[model samples]
Target: MIFAVVGPSGAGKDTLLSGALAARPDLRLVRRVITRPTKAGGEDFEGVTEAEFQTRLAQGAFALTWDAHGLRYAIPHDQINGPQDVVFNGSRAALPEAVRVFPDLRVIVVTAPDAVLAARLAARGRETVSDIATRLSRAAFTLPDGIAATTVVNDSTAAEGISRLLAALQPVRA
Candidate 1:
């Protein structure tokens, strides 16, 4: 099964995903292809120029694709198949498309209080004051109807958040 992990900015989705992967050796993590610079840093992703991204899209190289924050993101078709359970960071805006493409996909939605969300984004130092405000404006993003999702709130220590994420992922593996 493939898991689409999604959350608003500052929800610590990437951090929790990393910790879960570290603790669960049997799980597979699929890195994404994105149109942002590789060094922009938050999660592990392949950064390509818009031209290269378009080329790949035209070649039908992606199993799932979406646009967010003015950037294009994709999951390569070759990476989702295997014996082990696979998880990829995904966007909520494209969950409907994701459901259509990977019908059995499980969604893990990470969330945090608005205050926590605001603090984390400011701490990242990657976004300007205006940008952080823009992100916090959408902190209450909800999943589209018809999709069942397990929600994990990460307002505590990273360890606690990881534990919660692992618990959510384990039942699906069974």
Candidate 2:
């Protein structure tokens, strides 16, 4: 099964997933190919130039791809073909395409209060104040109708959030 974790920026998706993976050795985390510099951190990703990204896209390297915040991101085909239960950071807007690719996909939406999100983003120091504000102002996205999804609030400690996520994923974990 493929579990796609989607949420607003700074909502602790990566932190939550990291903790979950550490505790659940059976879960596999998929590394994404991103157009951001390697120094910029959040999730573990393979950073590449825009030109390189375009070249790989043309070469059919990605199973799913999308653009957000002026950068492009992709999931390689091999990452989703494995037998293990895989999880990766994903975009809500791309869920349909992801579902089409992995029919048994489950979406895990990690969310937090607006203030918590803002504070977390500010602490990351990745984006400018203006950029953080823009991200905070962006409206929430709803999952496409009929798609299976679970919402886990990560407003507190990482352990709490990971527990919630793990509980939600319990039924599907093999």
Candidate 3:
């Protein structure tokens, strides 16, 4: 199964996914390719220049790709294949395309209260106040019809979030 772990910025998707992977050694995490600099810091990703990114895109190296925050992100084709239950840091908007590509895809949408999200984004210190506000104001997304998804709230401790994620992914692992 391919699990697309998705949510808005500052929803702790990376943190929760990291913890879940630590506990579930059998699961595989897909490292994404992003146009952002490595130091930009969120998920561990392969950072590349725009020219390099486009070159790969033209070569059909990506299974799925999307643009956000003025940068391009992609999940390499190789990572989505194989029998392992693979998890990728994904965007909600790209879920439809992902579903089209991988019929067994499951989406895990991590969420938190608006206040919690704002606070978390502020603490990151990677974006300006204006950017944080813009992210906070973005509306929540509802999974499209016929899409299989599970929602996990990560409003509390990292352990709590990981617990929820693991529980949600348990069936997939089987």
Candidate-wise lDDT, in order = 0.92, 0.88, 0.89
lDDT of 3 by residue, 9-123 (tens): 8899989999999999889999999998898776789999999999999999999999887889999998777878899988888888889988888888999998999899989
Q: Which stretches of candidate 1 lie over 4 Å from their true place?
A: 172-174
**In model 3, which runs have C-alpha deviations exceeding 4 angstroms?**
172-174
Deviation in angstroms for 68 in model 3?
1.1
> How far off is residue 130 in model 3, in Å?
1.9
Model 2, TM vs. native: 0.92
What is model 3's C-alpha RMSD? Answer: 1.7
Error of 2 at 75 (Å): 0.4
Ten-residue stretch with the least lDDT total in model 2: 165-174
Q: Give the winner by TM-score.
A: 1
Highest lDDT against the true fold, candidate: 1
TM-score of each: 0.95, 0.92, 0.93
**Best of the two (2, 3) by TM-score:** 3
Q: Looking at model 1, which ten-residue stretch has the lowest summed lDDT?
A: 165-174
RMSD of each: 1.4, 1.9, 1.7
Instruction: Sort the predicted structures by TM-score, highest score first.
Output: 1, 3, 2
